[model samples]
Target chain A: MSWSKAMPANPVVAVAGATGAVGQEFMQVLHDLDFPASEIRALASARSAGKKIEFAGCGQVPAGELIVQEMTPESFKGVDIALFSCGAGISKEMREAVVAAGAVMIDNSSAFRMDEDVPLVVPEVNPDDVSWHSGVIANPNCSTIQMVVALKPLYDIAPIKRVVVSTYQAASGGGAPAMEELYSQTKDFLNGEELKVEVFQHRIAFNCIPHIDVFMDDDSTKEEWKMVVETKKIMGDESIAVAATCVRVPVLRCHAESVNVEFSGEVSVEAAREAYETAEGITVMDDCSSNTYPMPGLLAGTNDTFVGRLRKDPTVEHGLALWVVADQIRKGAALNAVQIAQLLLP
Target chain B: MSWSKAMPANPVVAVAGATGAVGQEFMQVLHDLDFPASEIRALASARSAGKKIEFAGCGQVPAGELIVQEMTPESFKGVDIALFSCGAGISKEMREAVVAAGAVMIDNSSAFRMDEDVPLVVPEVNPDDVSWHSGVIANPNCSTIQMVVALKPLYDIAPIKRVVVSTYQAASGGGAPAMEELYSQTKDFLNGEELKVEVFQHRIAFNCIPHIDVFMDDDSTKEEWKMVVETKKIMGDESIAVAATCVRVPVLRCHAESVNVEFSGEVSVEAAREAYETAEGITVMDDCSSNTYPMPGLLAGTNDTFVGRLRKDPTVEHGLALWVVADQIRKGAALNAVQIAQLLLP
Candidate 1:
């Protein structure tokens, strides 16, 4: 069931849900990567139809204001690639129309992530999974994206048996309104006003919310569950066990994870550092003497996954611990999707 | 080798470092617990001498302002109990003097925590450990105190083989100045002014700092090491393994931990919840249907250690995961030390 389509040297790109946070990031990443898009279109809901989104164009696409058009089934008529940051339902609803028009969709939603027909990809971990996608590719959750990027290089050293991770997730993972809520609530809290907590279950201004997304029957949030199942799917290994606790902190964009990994065989701290140093899309920022490690606030808008605080966990026979941080909207969303698009280029 | 002091029903209590955050909390908790004190003395550095702190009435002590006195070797004379929240150096320097004066020192510093003769205790977990302390009873680190309280009831179900905990610590753990720094820095960050990061290694406003305390030779922070070693000491099981990642979050007071525990035998979520419901000094706040759990911002000033988000981890044969939160100043430090002081009363 291998599927492949010949992508043009410079494809026509459509940025769906162009008014949202990750949607804007998709445009920025395309320009940052100098993606060769012959034409770029901005598509959104009817409410934002006439809005103008400025694009620092890429390749043949001229730098100008892109008029937001109301997205319809026909929006992808000649679009070679559609980058979607729309909600899951919208992504699913437009899936058929997107595929019918012969456009490849790199979706940033959780709609088709676990589907057998769609490839859940982190280019660093499993680029070849793209070869088997029917017409769509799914990006992993923001928290999962950064973690597996850090884990892949180490997994090459030894098969990872288990991972116990606790995340210091940022507000941006909840999208634009969530970020705005954090901003306004923080100002209100400091001003001695009642905090308006609408985007999240609790006041996310200076608090940590252990719940993310929706709760499952098992009481694990869908965000935590996504990390567990998506990692196995992307890593293409059903044997690797992942236990994740996703918590939302007041950080604006970047997410940090304290990950404890157990491997089937011993992997020393020195060996793990050497492996990460040679691995692609990873920067080692670990230096205890200098008091250096990745801080989420300082790492917003970064492309590479930063790994630090590498140490051996003496509790387990073959355990290693590390701190991972990456910009949730960039490497965790838009940048990752665009990277997958580059892989599709002929 | 064992020592016990006969404490009078109404003994004089001296609060060392009375002007600091935990020291002030010690005063509040003494009043909250209705501690019996014939007279209360406020002791601090010479700079703070003559300053007055207001205290509510506690038992035989009347409601009034206590004049601050410069602490010296003679300060402990005729003092039956000395609750110390001073820095480690001062605690170490004054230890022998306080002990020689026949005053039992309940130290809130890390000075003698790991010492062979000092009992590092969380009153809820190891009250009996107080009997072996020759003079000073060490209060466990704020992060460790809350965790051991949550772990104790679970440990009663089955022997915990190992624990992996990640902390979302508040600013208050660093003392009153640190809390003030957070306040000012957060205001600066929101107002677009440059942040002054004097108390912490980095700007902690809307950010998470993975490095807490000093970095050890193993690249693990000393705060992380404290949790590892202190948990084993308080739990009285040298075989139990613990790995901790201590991060300072933006929250002002309470500390929250995402703890993953593996036991020698299976411990179901139902049984864990039941144990927590009946456990002393514990509150069960988990109810996913209502989006209920312990949040640090709302849990400040609360006395009990809260356990929530209880779920079984399918990663290990006998594993359970839970989130624990407690006010760092209350259960973690002041209240625990005050409880230990109560144990000495005849």
Candidate 2:
């Protein structure tokens, strides 16, 4: 029943939905991280089968092509680690098959994220949570993953009391099709052509959409709900209060957040800056005078979470605000999942 | 000294910086509102002199064209209301001249906004503040103007203790040149050509720049500072605390705000919606199921402040959160100034 028993030196990594955006990132991250994988399988829906995914391999991993195969229960028969980003429903349906095949599911979907038994892991924030996983480790939501990664070091300096985050998320968070939609619509906007709004509810090119995901009964979008709940679970601090407003912008790849964190004790801007500087997987780009701050356009393909705009929120007693950005597909989903798999290595 | 004494059936109006974006909006708004102007003078820098500005007349105001004149102190000699959108320095230099010419200067520049002697007005929020003006009434910052208009209605329901606002501001808030830069840069971005970041400090096409204006010693941008100070001044409440993160998006005209307001007393979402519904110069657009929310793409050129995404913020004792959008050039600048001019009329 434990994940530890199935750990392997050269794990058989299977990427479900390999033809999709986050799925492709899973392959790229595995190659970039030089993860020790004896075999890598690219599994997708029947429609995408026979497609080829290029792996720009690193270290011992050979640079080669992975032909997409149909995803079925038999796909996980020999896999040690199964990375799932197909969808929540697919993840739920395939959970038992992957577990029955003795493979740990590092899910990018929201299916098992809130499950008490399945540990939601952000490697930098809570790698130890991976140790308790019963064959499944959930990757935190993209926005929550980046925010928590930036806040972890600060939280260590002084316990976080509350967090107010407003996200400037990119179209990539909606998947490759959404990114393409943004591109086509923007071109249409420039060409004096009528825009198509199939993927998104409204025109997203040259505009900001405040609604992301379905609206909950309380009026907060489900994306906002994920940030609130996932942060508490991942940080293992239920007492910490979180309020989020998730808005989708026209950027292609990275997600940027304006976070206001109020601490239990006074944490100076100097101390917070130092903590971020020393934190793993965080690049501090906060020199105000030089105009050195993270923009999504610049941080599109970057793995590290860029932190900037560090200042005091004068409204609260011990409040510090920061701006955080990261490539949503990489560190927010695929890379974090790979890191969790790394944590499970024997 | 009362503005009541200068009330005329047909007053002479002069628009300083008439060649600029906001100044053009000044003419459009004046015509649209059909202000009883006996004469309309288009005044700009000497380089723009002799250019013709056509007025699409409204109601009783006849359609005609005015020849752009070189802005000089003498230009305001016979003017009753001088609308100024010239830069801060010009506003400061021309303040005395406009007043000496026996005219009320409804200044759009930040030069006199924070001055204790000058009234910073949003008309809907602080129209009476204009009464104490010594021949000059300052327009609030664009981002601040929309936010205060949305908050004023909610604030009347219960005193606001603190406000956390994150703005998705358009390029027009930066002026006409900034909007042009967005257009050109977006075209460049689409064409795979080098993007020119001249008007703004960074590439604003398909990107969100956290740095709006020059950064201060505390690392907050000048635009953020304006929102804080101007909100306090316009609301006429020094006790209310405000924290703002102003980001420039790729949108052309309207500025949107995600506001989290904490009140001293209980305020339900229904009550807040009702407050915005009954409030003047405000429109509520909060039907989540129908996906009817005010977005900048649909709100450009609108005069009324749009409020939507109404929900209760559970983080505080009595907190409510909402989304606000308004045409940055119209209600945020020219329309607000014209409204102030309307207040001066009998």
Candidate 3:
């Protein structure tokens, strides 16, 4: 029963925090991508440990056979790459140890994003930054990642002077419990009963929550701050200003953005379309004629960041506006970390 | 038995789109505010001409007793003030006619919005504009009326250089049929059947559509165009820029907007909050600590525009952002029109 017909020599690739939504997607992607992994390891919290997990119908992964091991620096032994989709707290606790053990840790938490030693990577947007990873490559924020992937190529065509983005984020980014919050609250509301709130500060079923992450003294939430700083880092432009208002939409999987951009020089709507059409990991859905454009329902399950609603900002001399939608769980998180792993594969 | 003994000398008022959602709200507001209307002439089209409607248990209003008349010039001859929430075509043909009959027409339609002679008024934002109207005072687009009303006073204090708003609109804005479409589609989706969309181009059961109105030559839709033009006319600053992405959400009422504002001078988040708190018709719902803010569930049945998530745009020198929620059919269209009628008491 040895399956050794076409495996790559990367030894074994492990996905830490592998039982959650993003974690499950990581396993599916590894199999879907046919990554050259000689061995595969699925890990999660100790409680989720010993759970049976299968990959690509690769037969049964028996319970208690592969215990959900703890994420420790020692856990990185013999692993060529570790895709970390665990929270920043977990990444902080074990990332150093795992990287010290020789595995290239691609952390999907904010712990290392602003770290000068860590290179924040969006393969299509800034693959060049990958070369400088100090054994710990950082994954940008979910909202920030998709925005940069959509804005980078456009920025190259016409330098962006400022970016105004307001995100309608999906609940899946909050992990499984937040998904439960939306589901349970929705049923309660439809039944004409008062919805109980816990996972969120307010009822999230039929409403939009303006707060994401902890609020700063300045009133901006941490999620909003990410778009501000991450854009400057990923685009390698300190002069280009960015502002964001992130909202938690009742949607379950995709993150959508309405973006207004001001460029340093004149850039027509057609030119902006040309810029995105040629960029990798980006798709232009700018068919305002049929009202055909990027939207959450369409972006779900896809890997590409959808960009649309391209038009000249009639208010400014060199400005254009667009609507961006992307699968936050995919390109915004798990898929991106996996792609970074692919870049490291032999 | 003459009930005239109890009636004040208040003039008679008529509601042209009675029986519609906004019309019902108008009736509620009249009762709540104890508006000094000696009598209420509940008016509607021929089909609903014989239906009995109730409001605050004021007594049943028989549609047939409503005169079962068309909204003709002559129908308005006795109306001291006509508050209209009818369709655009109906309002267009009757607006001037109503005025000719010595009644002030407050129309909730795009039919007269861009007309230079018709003043687009959001009473709280600019009651003075009411004086400029010959007789037909226009209600700005539902989305525009709320945003500008929330931003107008702030714009005066800081002078908005640019505004980028992404609206999460409700189905009722498209009228009752759209609301039915949302409900029916949800049931169909639950039954595992493919949902058929009639009111919208795509399935909107649990989805958000970025399209609103037909697209124009410049790629902007009629909905977006109205917001841009109406904001200027209502704000009396044609030079003030606005870009909007109007979306139809699954909700039943209250349109929410994520607004990013870049002003001429530095606008602190604190100053913005104070500005909204002082602005007429604007209710500041900011309290990110508890996540208490503008939400449709809380905003439904309300007349005032709710503002929250007020924060400084950290990316720009002079920027402030917000999340604004208001009952689109009410503040966005109906109540605002009613408020204008209150401005001119004979």
Q: Judged by TM-score, which candidate is best?
A: 1
Model 1 scores a TM of: 0.99
Q: What digit string (tens of lDDT, one per residue) describes model 3 on residues B139-226?
A: 7889998898888767877788888888888888887778788777866755578888899878776677888988888888889898
Ordering by lDDT = 1, 2, 3
Report the candidate with higher lDDT, 2 versus 3: 2
Displacement of residue B334 (Cα, Å) in model 2 is 0.5
Residue-pair clashes, model 2: 0
Off by over 4 Å in 1: A1-4
Runs off by more than 4 Å, candidate 3: A1-8, A57-73, B1-9, B57-74
Docking quality of model 2: it rates as high
lDDT of 1 by residue, A1-346 (tens): 5555678999999999999999999999999999999999999999999999999989998899999999999999999999999999999999999988889999999999999889999999999988888899998899999999999998998999999999999999999999999999989988999888798999997799999999998889999999999999988899999999999999999999999999999899999999988999999998888888999999888899999989999999999999999999999999999999999999
Kindly list the per-residue Cα lDDT of model 2 for residues A176-260, writing each as its tens digit.
9999999999999889999999889899998989999999989999999999999999999998889899999999989999898
Which ranges of candidate 2 are over 4 A from the true structure?
A58-61, B1-5, B58-61
Better of 1 and 3 by TM-score: 1
Worst 10 residues of 1 chain B by lDDT: B1-10
Q: Is candidate 1 or 2 superior in TM-score?
A: 1
What's the best-to-worst order under TM-score?
1, 2, 3
Write candidate 2's Cα lDDT for B139-193 as tens digits: 8899999999999988898998999988999999889999999999999988999
Q: In model 3, what is the error at residue B204, expressed in angstroms?
A: 2.1
Which of the numbered candidates is closest to the native, going by highest lDDT? 1
Every model's TM-score: 0.99, 0.98, 0.92
